[model samples]
Target chain A: MIEFLQYHLPVLLIAIPLIAAPLAVLLSNRYIVQSLALAVCWTTFGLAIWMVAIVNQSGPVSYELGGWAPPYGIEYRVDQLNSFVMMFVSGLGAMVLTYSPYSLKAEIPLSQHYLFYPMYLLCMTGLMGMCVTGDLFNVFVFLEISSLSTYALISLGRTRRAPLAAFQYLIMGTIGATFLLIGIGLLYQMTGTLNMADIAEQLEAQRLVNDGQWAGSRTMLVAFAFLTVGLCIKMAVFPLHTWLPNAYAYAPSVVTAFVAATATKVSVYAFIRVVFGIFTPQFAFELLPLDTALWSFSLVGIFLASIAAIFQQDVKRRLAYSSIAQIGYMLLGISMADVDGLSAGIVHMFNHALIKGGLFMVVGCFVLRLGSVQMDDWKGAGRTMPWTSFAWVLGGLGLIGVPVTCGFISKWLLLTSAIHNELYPVAILMLISSLLAVVYVWQIVEVLYFEEPSEKAKHATEVPPLMLLTTYTVVGANIVFGVWTTYSAGLATKAAKALLEGGSL
Target chain B: MFVSIFILTLLVVTAITIARIGDLWAAVMFTGIFSFLGACWMLILDAPDVAFTEAAVGAGVSTFLMLGTLALAGKTEKPTTSSSVVPLFVVAVTGAALIYGTLDMPHFGDPNSPVQTRIEPSFMEKSQSDMHGLPNVVTALLASYRGYDTLGETAVIFTAGIAVILILRRSNDGFKSNDVFNSQSNSRKGSQ
Candidate 1:
């Protein structure tokens, strides 16, 4: 039983949530459904942690579905990279599910609460599915599953603007999905194989035998262009991020927190997988010149998103823009394409998810107490909702890369990588972006701490116990991961090494 | 060749109808027609799996979703104000770039192309032996070698579904029995 669990855990991690989601819907009782969803998420999180441990103990685990072999049957390949991301995503998912009941009651109607847990479970399942799947077309199918579900989840916000935001996301998201499909189709048409490992092997053979560049094949180039643009839209990279702010702003707090934490991070992972896994570094750097393009775009994204973040009045909108800027930091690291740089990017992906998840949860708490997240409404919330306010500030500090926070660790690694590359200007730009984060975070801090308390807030109490507990859990994780860099940094380094070494899929 | 031409023509006609339709319902119907034509084209291209997915998702599910949205937002088309030359220029440039780039591509169905010569041979010859019992190479690939990407994609769909439900699910008792216009009249009387 133990051996079987160890071997087949990856599929179970996804199946648990996938099955639990619909089961929750069938149960239809609010409390029961929420508990069931929470249980499943927690179990999945535990399974992910164990899977990570097993991967560390062993190298990479490969499980063939229904006793099929690789390059023929669909394979679930688990390495240090995906296992680490799986842990972060599922861990945050469990925490967010714990926070949802209290948060949902304030924003969503009582009747809708029953639907909320199930949908969340399904979303988590989709994210996990995307992380674990090894096939190209399966990626598209799962992408649609996640995309369609997210469209529904975002539209469930109570605000009238929710529909419009969802519609915008829907349109943009569909285009992105379609572009991705076209890219995959072209690749399939060219290679006549949907298996990534097979494609990699064939490409390697072609590289060795033929002086001609398969990497520079027009079909491959078109696929690269389509995939990059599509993923950029999904990641909310600068100039393509218009749908994000409103979607985040108008979404119910729970939804915002979950999406903020996981959605774009998953997309970034997809980008990395395509750039590094499918197209080897030699091809990506030599044929596509991806590093140059990504570097320039990331630099522009850092500055532009920071400037935009500073101008937002709504707290959620500010965080949304700030997220785009932070994504720049991750992209900058990835653009370097070295082991250390990629490590920084992967580490930041984990750290940023924690920070954003905690921050959004704090915002949700404020919404519960004050009924809004406007800067003015947060006036003197520090004095009333002291724990929640402190969590927000600490989370803000993490976002700003203050010392002894998870954000600082990520920044330190990124800066070290940049300096190692002799890219002093990019390193300086990173510092500048941190300063901008400081400015935006301080704005919220000022409202919560320094500004006079509104008359309405005199009676404001701390959010419910569950909300406070969730906030503290993520905040504590931020601090712990920040102080002890052993696990997160190690996993990131291993994953980066795998990519840098150009491991065959 | 004739089938390809016929399917292409039908697709073009449906697309035009979708673009030109004045009524939202008509537009929705035309969109369905367009997708149906597209699915048929995919079928003619010898991609039954893709055609099935397109028919089920594009023509059926999406059409239903659009109509549901129209019911919520009202079925009237927002009045168009003026011609948009900027958009036209952008489209022209984009289209031209795409066409220019495609000119370098290997001809359709070229057996000697690098891609067809390299990977296709392995998949064609070895897939059955590689996977043992699995007959469909696509399914095998989807579930195995690239399963990680599929996992992520599934998460994306699940997230999108949750997001939609979270955003659009209406609050009970938020809406009154009367319409906004009626409520406004009642409020006016009360104020007077």
Candidate 2:
């Protein structure tokens, strides 16, 4: 029984949410939907915790679907990396679902509340699916699934702007999907195989011999370009991030919390997979000079997004731009292409999700109480919604990479990696960006605590108990993970080693 | 060579239809046609799996979704005029760049190309041993060796579905009182 559960655990993690998604939609009862969504999320979260324990003890585990063996059957492979990510994604999903009922009551219409739970489940399933799969084309297919659902989730906002935001995201997202598909098609044309490990093996075999023939082929180069651009768009990297602000701003608070927490992080994971898994670091770095390109683009993204974020009046939009800037830090770490660098990127992915998820949940609370999240609307909210406001302050400090926070650990590792590479300027740039983060986060902090509450806001009470509880849970995790990095950071390091060694070790 | 030319012309026609069709509904239908033609081209290139997905997702599912959206929004497109030169120039540049990129590419279906040389040998030789009993190499690769990516792609689909539901689902209480913008318009018509 123990072995059976261990082997089937990955599927159960995904299945719980996948099955519950449609069930939530079918049940249509508000209370039922909330309970079912929470149950599924918590169950998956528990499974993730168990899987982590199993993986820690046994190393990586690969389970083939329907008794089919690899390189033929669909395989779910869980290692240190994905297990850690699973914990974050599933844990966030559970907390957000817990918070949603209260937030939805104020922000979403009664008729739409039932749909929220199911959509949340689907989104969680997509993020988890992305973390666990080993196939290339399947990645594209799953990407589409998550993207299509995200567009719907974004549009569910009650604001008039929600439709327009959703439409814009749809357009950009479709373009990203098309680019990924074209890239996959080109790769298929070249390699005739969709298995990333198989492709890597073939490439390696070819490289062992003096095989310069296919090294710089147009088809391969084009494939690389498509994958990079598609991922960049999905990650909301600097130039391709136009769709993010509005979508995040107008999206319902729960949706914002979930997407901001998981979406771009998954995209970063995809980028790492393509760079290290499919192409191999040698080919990607030496043959294509991808590392250099990634470095420059990420640096630019950090500065530009930070500058852009400083001017925003709407709190959610401001955070959206800040999210873009945070993505730059992750990308910068990835571009370093060293062990510490990859570890930094991976750790930051987990850390940022916690900070952003907590922050957005707090925003949701504000929106619930005041019915708006504009800077002006939050005036004097500190005095009324004391716990919620305090959580936001801590989350904001984490976003600014304050000492003893998860964000600081990631930033410190990134800086260390940059200095190790003797990229002193890059290190300085990272610090500057953190300062920019401070500015934007401070802007919200000031509005929430320093400003006096207006007459309209005087009657605003604390958000419902569920929301406060959920926000506090993530916030607590953020601080706990920050102080105790043994598990999360260690998993990231192991995952980085696995990736850097090309799964051989 | 002749077949390539034929497919190219068909692609051009569909592209023009997508660009120029005035009715929003008609434009969506044309987009579906465009996807269908592309799938056929993929089939011709000997990629049945891709062709299957293209047909199902691009032609069938996407078209159904577009039609559903049209029903919710409206069938008729609001008339608006915009500068054409920007789009034309953008297309021209994109077309030129694509052509330039393809210039150094191995010719279509060249059996001796490095891609075929490097990959085909292993696929023909080792795939059986690698996957044990899987007959189809593509299926093997998609589900097994690279299954992690497939999981990600599945997640992408799930996310898209969630996003749609979240955006479209109504709140528990109901649509707001101010949701009756159309009511004001109806009253004006009544007054008229």
Candidate 3:
């Protein structure tokens, strides 16, 4: 049993949910579907934890699907980098599932509740598969899996415009997926292999001189360009982020929470995997010069999206814009191109998932009782529903990089890296962006805490215990981890080392 | 090369016709025709698997869905005499970039190209043994060597099915028991 589990755990992380997804659809009872989804999520999370530990003990583990050998097989290869990500994605999946039932009940109609579980599990399956697979083409297929599920989940919102929002997202996502497929096809044409390690090996060999002059072809460069641009669109990077705000804002609350937590983070993971895992950093940075573009986009995206967030009347929309800006911070860390910088990026993404996930859950609670998440609707809601409000405030603090929040630690790591790299201006930019985050978060804080209780606010009550419990579990982790940063930050640092050193020692 | 060029010219003409047609349904039909031409092109290029997917998806599924959408929104497109400057500018820039990017690619079907030289030889040579004597190399690679990708594609299709059902099917309305391609009135009858 132990040997079998050791070999098969990675695929099972995906299979458990993929199998559960169809089963949930077959069953009509909403409660059964919910329980099944929750069970699947927890099991995947447990498997992720167990697999990561085994990987740490035994260095990188390579499992070929159905006993096919590498360079000719679909490889479920886990290194420190992806295992760290696997843990984050699956753990978030489980936590969000715990939080979904109450929100789904409140937001989705009775007849549609059973369907939501299947979609949610399918989305989780897509993300988990994307993170674990070591094949380039497999990433695109899973990306579509997650993207299609997300569109449907978003359209399940009660708002009249939800379908339109979903349609817009579907169009943008399909275009992004197509661009990605074309990019992967180009790579396959160039390298004649879909396995990432084999491609990396070929590209590295192609770097050698035919007659001492640089032998790498421009066709490969174009392939890299297409891949990067396609991933940027998928990741909602800066100018390509037009489809994100409305999609997140208009989606049903549970959908937004899960997607905002996992989808973009996994997209970023794919982007990194393609760049650093498949193509060496020297080639990416020196030959392609993408870091320059990344840095510029991150700098502008941070300021612009944060400024947009500050002016939103609806709280969910405000947070949606804030997500774009937070994405910029993660990009900023990645653009620094060193171990410390990469750790900062990875840690910040994980922290942001928890922060943003908890924040969106709070919004779900507000939308549940108040039927709206506009700032006006929140007038003195803090007084009426103290626990939910408190959780929201805690989540807000994490977003603002307060001292006792997860956000602060990541920002500190990022700032120190910026200074160490002697990018003084970037250090200053990081500080300025945190202040911008504070301004938007403060707008939310002022409404939640300072305003007088409206009549409806006075009538508001705490969300059900399970929902409240789940939200605080995430919110409280932000505070607790900020004080003791060894585990989370340590894993991130190890992941960074793995990527920078090319593999685990 | 001659066949490919002829198919390519036809494809360009189809696209231009699609652009010029004001009848939305006709444009959709032209689009399907274009996809069929593309599938034929792929078949001539010796990628049967890709040709099959393009035929099924680009021609079949896409046309079906476009028709459904046309039925939902009115089929008749409004003809506007608006200036096409912005669109033309965007098209020109995108076309220029794509053409420039294609300059570095190996010419069609060049056996000596870097793409044909690397990695594939090993797969083809070793597949009889490595793939456990699978008769078809592509099937072996797709099912065993690249099986994870197929799994993901399965999820993608499954997700698409669930997505369309969620968006278009009214849950528990009894109409859902009717086929998705059924006309609205037919579904209404099922609901009744």
Candidate 4:
């Protein structure tokens, strides 16, 4: 069994969830289906952990689908970078699925419960597929799998705006997917391969053949631009973030928590893979002005979106805006284009997933008991539901980059990386942006604790223990990973070094 | 070449008509026509398999689904009050960028192109041996060499089917007259 798992874990990690999705629908018993979905999620999470261990023990693991060699077949490649990402994605999927049943009771309709489990599992499968697949077109295929299911999951929201939000997301997501396909097609035209490693090797050979003029090819540049923009939209990076706020705010709370944490993070991972793995940092940063452009957009996006978060009245919407700003931090780290900076960015993906996933689950608790996500309705919630409220405080502190939290570790690494690169001004700007996080986080903290209890808050009690336990589990991970930098930051640095070593294979 | 040009022209015309038509029923029909024209162009380009799939899936099935939607919903589209300048500019810029990118591409059916030179030769020989002498290489490739992608494609269709069911299925499929649902839907209605 051990020998079997060593070779097949990568494919099994994706296949388990993909197969369970349709199986969930077939079962059609809400209770049994939910249990099955939960089991599948945890099982995939276990497989991801095992895969990570195998990768750490070995170097990188590549599995040929149906025994065909790569560049001619779909390959599932798990390296330090993606295996790390896969672990968090499946980890959060398991956590959220655990928290989902009780919270989903109040938000999603009972009749739709069975359908919701299938979509959730499919979305998880798609996300993991995107992480593991070595083929560029395979990325697009899994992107659609995740995206289509996400739209369906969002439309299952209780509010009337859910369908509208889902429709808007569907439009923007389709455009992004189309742009990505066009970019991949253009690259295939240039390199004649869809496998990322082969494409990278082909590009390197072409550069040599052209005496380093290959990077200047208009087709290559156009493909790079399209892939970056398409990924930016999917990542909800600032100006292109119109679809995200409404989608996160209006979706069922569990969906919000899961999608908010994983979807954009996976897109960011994809962007990194394209830029570093396929395009090479030297080509992206030196041959072009991509680094400068990325940092400028990321800096402006951070300040703008962080300020926007302060003005949002709905708690979920505020968190959504905060998510955009947090993404800017990740982008900023990427722009630095060094081991420290890249690892900081990668570590933040893990940290922010835990922080934001925990915070959203807290919001779901409020939505469950208080029946409103409005800040006014949540006044004095801290006193009535102390545990859940304290969970928010922990998550909020992590968001604010307070000491003894995972958020601080990423910020510290980012700060040092900036200063190391003689980017003092950028460092200061990052600090100022952290202050903006404080302002938005404080606004909620004040409402929850300081203000007089609303009628709803007064009547509301703590959520069920299962939901609260899952919330704390995620929130507590923020602290645990915060203190223990070995797994989060250490693994991220290894992944970053591997990525920068070229081709990420 | 003349027949391909005529089909391409009709494809462009149908696409514009689908975009400009006020009535969605007509728009749907025009979309079907556009897809059919596109498929014809593909066939003229010697890709009958692709043409057949596009015609059956894009023109036939999607148009039927759109008509079903129109029957259930309304047929007319709402006129936009917002300015079209921004969207028009965005579309023009994207189209220009795509054209600029295409300018560097090898001419149609250029044998020296990387796509033709690098992999196509090997695929022909590989299919005969690896695919057990399958007559059609496309089928062999789709079913064997890149079969995982086909599985993913099937999963995409599955996801879409489930999405349609999730969104359009009757709300009261199960849990008839449960007080939990009653109160929840009532609150939802009140919130709306």
Candidate 5:
């Protein structure tokens, strides 16, 4: 049984959710569908943990679907990088599922509860598929699956503006996906394979034959441009981020928590995979001056987005902007193009998912009790719903990169990496961005503690214990992973080393 | 070759007409015509299967749905006051970039191209031996080798269907099957 599972787990991780998605709809009973989704999520999380164990024991694992070998059939490949990513993503999905039922009651219409589960499962399947699949075209297919479901999920928000937000996202997301398909098509035209590793090998061979000049080909350059721009749009990097704030603000709280945590992070993962795994680091950085471009964008995005976050009155939108700034930090790490820097990027990605996801869950708790996500409405919430507000404070500290928090570890690594690479300006700019985070986080703290209670806050009480438990579990994980660096940071360093050394040990 | 050029010109003209028309009803009809022209071009390219599918699905079923939507919604589009120059410029640049990228591509029907040389010949051979000499290699590959992609496509369609129902359904009425059933039966009785 163990051996069978070890061999088949990668495909099963994706296939289980893909199949369960439709089944959740067919079952159609709210309670039944809810439990079904919960079971599937926890099961996926368990499988991810088991897969991590397997990958740790074995270097990497690849599965060929339908008994066909790779470069021919679709391949699901999990290395240290993706396995670590899959672990957090699935774990977060399971956590959100646990928190969804009660949160949905307050925000989502009861009639749409069953429909929501299937969409959630579909989104999970798509994300997991993207992480696991080695076939570039397969990634596109999964991207659409997740994106379509995400649009529907976002439109299920209580406000009428939800559909408009969803429509806007649909337009942007479709364009992004189209660009990605064009890129993959171009690459396949050049290399004649959809398998990522095979494409890399072919490109590397071509580079060698051309005396390291093949990367300068117009076709390759165009393909790289399209792919990077497509991923940046999906990642909501700076100027392309017009769609994110409203979508995150209007979606049901559970949807916001899940999508904000995983969607952009997965896009970042795809960006890393393409740049370092498919195109060599030599091509991405040295050949194209991409590092300079990335760091410039990252610096501007960090400052501008942080300023935007400070001006937002809606708490969810504030966090949404903060999420963009956090993404800039990850990009800054990637721009460094060294082991410590890449590892910092990877660590920050994981840490931000936990922190932002936990913070959003705290927002859900407040929404359930206070019936509003506006800053004024949350006035004196700390006095009323003490536990939930405390959770936010804990999550807020992580966002501000306070010492002994997960956010600080990533920030510390990023700072040291910048200085180590002798990019003092970049290091100083990152510190200033953290101070900006302090301003926005302080805004929330002031309303929760200093201001007098609003009418809603006076009536607000602690959320249901189950919801509180799940929120605490995530926020607590931020601290746990912060202190116990052996798992999160350790795994990220190993993965970065492997990625920098041509994706193998 | 002359026929291909004529069809291609018609396709471009139809596309521009669809964009320019103010009456949504006419625009939608132009869209159907545009898809039909695209199908004809595909047929000329010897992809009869794709042409047939596009004709039936894109031109036929999509037009029917558009007509249904027109019945429920406005027949005319709302005019936008925004400037068109930026959009036009963006489109021009993207088109130019794509053309530039294609400049480095192998000529049409070049056997030395990666698509022609790599993996496809193996697919052809495998289709012959694996499926008792399947006549259509595309079908064999789609069904047997890359069936998971087909499944993913099916799931995408399913997601679209579910999204439509979720967005369009009246939440106040609830999604219970009895409500749907009673409404259908009532309509039948009224007709009778």
Candidate 6:
């Protein structure tokens, strides 16, 4: 059993959700289907944790599908980087699934309840599978899988605008996917292999022979360009973030929490893995002004998205725009292009997921009780639904990088990295963005806790126990990860070490 | 090169026509024509697999979905309610930038290009050792060397199916009225 698991654990982590996804629609009883999906999520979550443990003990773990060898077969790679992402992805999956039933019961139509389970499970399969795969083109395939399911899942929102939002996402997502395909096709043509490790070695070797001219081919440059743009768009970086707010604001609150936490983070991982992993930082940064481009785009995203977030009256929309700004922080770390910076970025990915996931879940609780999430509807409701409101404030602090919350840890790491590099402006900008966060968060706080309780909010009570429990669990985790930085930061350091060393494989 | 250029010219012309035409139905049909022409261009570039996908997905699935949408929403082009200059400017800038970026690329299909000399030939040799010989090598690559990608593709298609069900399933009324759908489609075309 140990030997079998050692070989198949990576594939099993992906396949479990996939196998369960199809089975989700078979049950007529929605309860059974939800239970099955929840079970699948928890199982995958367990597998991800175990997989991370195994990877830690034994360097990188690689599984070749159908006994095929590397450079020739499909490879599932679980290294420090991916294992870290895997734990967050599947862990977030389980947490979101745990919280979903309560939100789903209140929000989604009954006829669509069974439909939701299948799509949710399939989306989980797509995200997990995307992170686990090692092949470059394979990432594109899994991106599509996750993206398609996400579009459908978002369209299942109760509002008429849901389908329109889903359609908008589909258009943008397909364009991104096509760009990815074009980029991968170009890379395959240039390097003659799809396996990431093989491509890296070949490119590295060719650079040595041709004094780097071969690696500097315009085709190579274009390939990198397409891949970067495609992925940045998928990551919702700066100008490419138009599709995000609507999709998040209008989707079912359960979906908003899940996709908000997992989707863009996975896309960011893909960008890091593809651009920084296969392209190798030496070639990417030297041959191109990639860092300058990243810094500019990310800086703009931080200020612009944050300012936008503050203007939104709808609480979910506010959080949605805030997500774009948080993503900018992650990108700022990428722009630093060193081990310390990378570690900061990866830690933020994990911690931000917890923060945003919990915050959105809090929004879910509000929508569940108040029937809408506008700021006016939440007035003085905090006094009535004290527990849920308190959890929201906790999550809001994490978003603001408050002390003793996970958000603070990542922001501090990012700040130090920025100042270490003497990018004083960047450091100041990060501070400004964090302050922007405080303003928006405070605005919501005042409405919820300070203002007169509206008549609509007069009857509001705390959300159901299960929902509140899950939200508080994530909120507590934000603080725990913040205060006890040893675990999350340690994994992030391991991942950063692996990524910046041109990969262990 | 001449044949490919001829096909390219036709494609460009078709695209221009599709854009200029105000009749939505005609534009949709022209889009199918453009897709077919694109598949032909892909064939000229010696990428039959990509051509197949473009034809099936672009011409087949997309056209069908557009028709379904037309059945629900009026197909006639609304009056130009939005400004065109900003969009046009954006396209111009982007197109110019793309053209500039291409200036450094290797000429098309240069035999000694890095593409031919790089990692793929070696990867092919490595794959030759597997039981599956390179009979229709793209298939081998897709099925064996990249089996997980194929699995992902299956998931993508499955997700799309689910999306269709989610968006369309809730409204049972739309499916029952073929006459209304057809009349709506016809009126839209008539207005155009």
Compared with the true structure, what per-residue lDDT tens digits does model 6 show for residues B24-128? Answer: 888888999899999999988888998999999999989988887778776788768788999899669756645655565556888666556654455456556
Instruction: For candidate 2, write residues A1-505 as lDDT tens digits.
Output: 9878877998888777877877887899988988888889898999999998888898887877665554545667787877888888888878887878767766666777677777777777777877777667767766766777788888776666777898999899888878888887777666556667766765566556645545435656777778888888999998899999989988888889999999999999888888887777776787778878877878888888888888987788889998998898888888888899999999999999999999999988877777676777778888988898899989988999888889888998999999999999889978887898888888887887888786546888887777788899898888888999987778888889988985541
**Runs off by more than 4 Å, candidate 5:** B173-192
Docking class of 3: acceptable
* Model 2, global lDDT: 0.79
- Who is ahead in DockQ, 2 or 6? 2
Residue A41, candidate 4: Cα error in Å is 0.8
TM-score of each: 0.89, 0.87, 0.93, 0.97, 0.95, 0.92
Query: Which residue window of length 10 is worst by lDDT in model 2 chain B?
Result: B181-190
Identify the leading candidate in terms of DockQ.
4
* Candidate 5 whole-model C-alpha lDDT, 0 to 1: 0.88
lDDT value, candidate 4, whole model? 0.90
lDDT of 4 at A490: 95
DockQ of each: 0.28, 0.31, 0.33, 0.49, 0.30, 0.31
> Considering every candidate listed, which one attains the maximal TM-score?
4
Give the whole-model CA lDDT for all candidates, comma-separated.
Answer: 0.80, 0.79, 0.82, 0.90, 0.88, 0.83
> Lowest lDDT 10-mer window, candidate 3 chain B?
B179-188
True contacts kept of each: 0.32, 0.42, 0.49, 0.55, 0.44, 0.46
- Candidate 1 is graded, for docking, as acceptable
Tens digits of lDDT, candidate 3, A1-505:
9888878888888899999998999996988998888899898899999988988888888878888766667777888777878787888788888887767765666788788889999899888888988888878878888888998999886564677788888887887888788778877876778888888877777666454222445666667777877888778888889889889877888889889999999989888888788777777787667788888889899999999999988788899889999889888888888988888999988899989988998888887777677788788998889999988889999999999799998999899889999999989987998898888888777888899987668888988898899889988989987888876788888888888885331
lDDT winner between 3 and 4, please give it: 4
* Greater-DockQ candidate between 2 and 3: 3
Could you tally the backbone clashes for each prediction?
69, 65, 0, 0, 0, 2
Error of 5 at A58 (Å): 0.8
For chain B alone, what TM-score does every candidate structure achieve against the true structure?
0.82, 0.81, 0.79, 0.88, 0.85, 0.80
Ten-residue region with minimum lDDT total, candidate 4 chain B: B175-184
True contacts kept of 1: 0.32
lDDT: worst 10-residue window of model 4 chain A: A209-218
- In candidate 5, what are the lDDT values of residues A70-171, reduced to their tens digit? 777888889999999999999999998898787887666688788889989999999988899999999999999999999999987766677889999999
